[model samples]
Target: MAKSKVYFTNLRASFGRNLLQKLEKLIKEAGIGNIDFQNKYAAIKIHFGEPGNLAFLRPNYAKVVADVVKELGGKPFLTDCNTLYVGRRKNALDHLDTAYENGFSPFSTGCHVLIGDGLKGTDETLVPIDGDYVKEAKIGAAIMDADVFISLTHFKGHEATGFGGCLKNIGMGCGSRAGKMEMHSSGKPHVNQQLCVGCGSCQKDCAHSAITITDRKASIDHSKCVGCGRCIGRCPVDAVEAASDEANDILNCKIAEYTWAVVKDRPCFHISLVVDVSPNCDCHSENDLPIVPDVGMFASFDPIALDQACADAVNAQPSVPGSILDERERCHHDHFTDTHPDTNWESCLEHGVKLGLGTREYELITIQ
Candidate 1:
C-alpha cells in the first residue's frame, strides 16, 4: 500500500488567522472537502471531558468542525458513547449534563450533543466483523446511523491503551455498554464487595436476574449473567466491576476491529489535536500534567495513518519537565511505552493495517 497523506500544522496563530481558523485550514488541506457532505447527517465523534478534566478539546475546536461540515451542506452534531466506568458520563442523562457542564453545550459547539448509546447505554447496532478477537462489534446506534463519520480527537495518554487517538475514539468510543464489555473483558463480570452499597440498582437492571444482594453485598451468578454490562452502568456505587481480563494486545486488536465496524460503510475523516497531552484518558475526572508540550493538530482521511502520524510526532518531541513521562524510567526509548510500560499502542495501528483500515506508513504534509 502507498503511504497515506497526513496533513499537519503547528499551533501558531497570528492576527490574520487563529487556532480555529488554522484547524479549518488543516482539515481542508487534508482533503476533508473531497468527502461529499451535502444533505447528509455527519457524526463528529469527540470526548466531552470528564467534568473536572481540563485536557479535553475545547468547544471552540468542535465549533470549527461543525461549521465546516455545515458549510459543506451537512448537518453536524457532536457525539460520544457513555463511558463504561463509574463517572459523570455513565448514562445519557448524566452524560449530557456533564457535557453541558464541561463546555460542550450545543450553543457552545454550534451543534447538538448526542449521547451515542442512548438513554441507558443500551441502544446499539451490531455489526458483524468476524475478526480473530471480535465476531461482531456492537457500536452505538446513533453513531452508526450517521451518513458520515468524523473523529475530532484530543490526542492523549491512556492507562489501558497507551494513547487515546482516532482509533480509540471511534472503536471504544463508539461501543455501547455491552459492546464495551465485549472488548474489555473475556468473561462474566463480578462484584467488588468492598465498594458494594447494596443499592439494588444492579439487581433491578439485570435482565437475566443474575445479581442478588445479601448482607449489604451484591453477588453475580455468572451462569445466569449474560454479560450485557447493564449492571456496570446502573450500579450507583460502582460495585459491579467489569471483568477486564483481556490482554492489552487483544484489547487493542478488538478496538481496531470495532473501529472497522464503525467506518467501513461510510465516508470518514479524522482530526487529532495533540494539545494538553495529558498522562491519561479524558475519561478520568481529573487530568495530570502533560507529559509533553502541545504538538499541534493533524488531519487525515486514513485513520490508521492519522494515528501513526500523531504517535510519531509525539515521540519526536522532548518530554516535559516534572511530568509522568519525565519521571518514568524512560527505558523503552519510546515515550508511550516508557510512560505506559504495560501497553503497546502499536498493536491497534498494526491490527488496523491487517483489517485494511489504513496504512501505518504516511507522508507528512506540513502546512502553514
Candidate 2:
C-alpha cells in the first residue's frame, strides 16, 4: 500500500569508475545485499538477443550481477525459457548456441546459461494460481527451482505488450512452450498450407495423432490436438504458427498472472536498463533504431514500481529523430500507445497491482 523505492542512475562515467562499476554500485545501494543469498541457487532471468538482434543487453552487464551474487556466496546462473516461435532459440541446444553466439558464456558472464524449459521446450513445472484467466502456469523447471529470482531486463518497446520491462521479462520470458502458447493464443496452432512442404515432421512429432499429411499439405485436427506447441517447434519449414487470437488486454493480464506464478513464495529483485529503447522485441532477428534517447538504469524490490518508473522516464524523454516515435502522428500523448495504437500497456501494471504484485506509487531515489 505504501510507495515502493526505485533507485536510478544515469549513464555517466569518470576515469575511476565505468558503467559496469556504476551498475554494481547502483544494485548494492538499492539493497540487493539485503537478501539472504548464501548458498542459494539464484536465477537471473534475461533475454540473450535473438541471434541477429543487436539491441539486447550485453553480457558485460550480466557479469556485474553474477560477480555480486558470487560475492554474497550464492550460486548464480543466467537463464531464459525457450521461445515459442521458429527461431534459433526454440530448444535448449539451439538456445544455448544463440546465447554463446551472442557472447554470453560462462567465460564471459562468470556463470552458466541454462535453457529454462530443457531440450524439447516441454520441461516445465506447473504452479497453481487460480486467477481470473490462468488456473495454472507452466514455467520452466530450472527457473522455478531457483531459491532466488532476479530480473535483469533490457527495457524496450514491443508490438504486443507495448514495452518489455521487468514483468515482461519475468512473466512471458519464463513461460515454457505451452505457457507461451496459452498467453499468445486462445486456440491451437494451424498449418499454413502454402508454406507446408509436407515433410511429415509435424505429423511424426504429434503425440496425439492430430496432424495428418495429404497431398503434400498438413492439417491439424483440433479435437485431438493438445496445444503443447511441439509441432510449432518441430516444423522444419516454419509452416506451423500459433494463432495469436488473444486480445492484447487479455494477453497483458495473463502475463501478470504468470509473473505471479513465478515470484510467489520466493525472494525476488528487479533491475531494468532503459537503453537502446528498441521499437520491437529482441525476439526479432533485427533491431530498429531507438525510438527515444536512453533514459537510465533502474532497480527496485517492487517489479511494478520498477516498470512504472522506467515507463515514466521513457515517456518524459524527447523522441529520437527519424525513429518510429518521431515519425508517428503523436495523436496519443503516451509514447507507447502512439507507437502501438492497439496495445494498452497500462493493463498489465494495473492487473499486477490488483493481484498484489506491488504498488505502482514509488519514490525515485537517484544514486549519484
Candidate 3:
C-alpha cells in the first residue's frame, strides 16, 4: 500500500501567519478538500469532553474545520455518541447541556452540536462487517446517516484500549450505548444491591420485566434479561453494572471492527490533536498534567495511519517532568503502552488495516 500522508502543524505562530492558518494549510495539503463537499452533510465526529475535563480539543480548532467545510460547500455539524457510563451525557438532553457547557455550540464552532444516537441512546443502525471479532456493529443513527465523516480526535491515553486515538474516537466513540455494552462485556448488567435505591426506575425502563425491587433493593432476573442495557442508564445512582470478565484483547479487536462498520463506504477524513496528552480518557471529568508537551495537530485521509502517526509522535517525545509518566519508570519506548501495559492498541490498528480502513504506514508532512 502507498504511504498515507499525515499533515502536521506545530504550536508556533508568526506575525503574518499563525498556527490556525497553518492548520487550514495542513488540511488542504493532506487533500481533505478533494472530497466533494458540495451539498453534503458532513459529520465532524468529536468528544465533547466530560463536564470538568479541560484536556479536550478546543472549540477554536473545530471552528477552523467547520469554516473550511462550509467554504467547501459542505454542511458540517459537530457530533458525538452518548456515553454508556452513568454521567451527564447518558441521555441526549443532558449530553447536549454538557456539550454546551463545555463550549460546543453553533455560535462557537460555526456548526450545531448533535447527539449521534438519539434521545435515549438506543436509536442506532446496525452495520454488518465480516471481521475476526464482531460480525456487525451498532453505530449511532446520526453518525451512520452522514454523507461524509470527519473524525476530530483528542489523542490521549485510555484505561481499556492503551490509548484513545483516531480509532478509539471512531470505533468506541461512534458506538451507541448498547453497542458499547457489546464491546465491553458479554453479560447483562446486574443491579448492585448497595447502590440500588429501589426507586423502581430500572423496573420502569426494563423492557424485559427482569428487574424487581424487594426490601428496598433492586434485583435482576438473568433468565428474563435481554441485555438491552436500558436499565443501566435509568438507574440514577449508577447501581447497574456490566460484567468485567470480557477479555481486553477481544474488546480491542471488536472496537476496530465497529470502527470499520462506521467508515466502510464513507469518504472519511481524520485529524488528531496531540495536545493535553492526558493519562486517561476525556470521559473522565478531570484531567491530569500532560504526559508530554503539546505536540501538534495531525490530519489524514486514513484513520489508522493518522493514529499510528500520532502515537509515534508522542512516543518520540520525552515524558514531561512532574507528569503522571514521571511517577512510573517502565517501558519508556511506547507511551500508550507505558501508561496501559495490558492493552495492545496496535491490535486495533492491525485489525483496522486488515479490515482495509486504512494502512499502518504513513509519511508525516510538517506544516511549519
In lDDT terms, which candidate is top? 2
lDDT of each: 0.93, 0.95, 0.88
Worst 10 residues of 1 by lDDT: 233-242
Q: Could you tell which candidate, 2 or 3, scores higher by TM-score?
A: 2
Per-prediction CA RMSD (Å): 1.6, 1.4, 1.7
Q: Summarize candidate 3's per-residue lDDT along 1-368 as a digit string, tens digits.
A: 99988899888888998877888888988888899999999999999999889999989889999999999999999999888887889989999999899889999999999899988788899898868877778899999999999999999988789889998999999998888988898777888888888999989998888998899999999899977777876778889887755677788888889988988887989998889999999999999998988899899988999999999989888888998787776664787777777778888888889888889899888877
Cα displacement (angstroms), candidate 1, residue 88, comes to 0.5
Clashes of 2: 0
**Residue 45 in candidate 3 has what lDDT?**
93
- TM-score for all predictions? 0.96, 0.96, 0.95
Ranking of predictions according to TM-score: 2, 1, 3
Clashing pairs in 1: none
- Point out where model 3 deviates above 4 Å: none
lDDT of 2 by residue, 119-150 (tens): 97888999999999999999999999999999
Candidate 3 or 1, higher TM-score:
1
Q: C-alpha displacement of 15 in model 1, angstroms? A: 1.4
Model 2 misplaced stretches (Cα beyond 4 Å): none
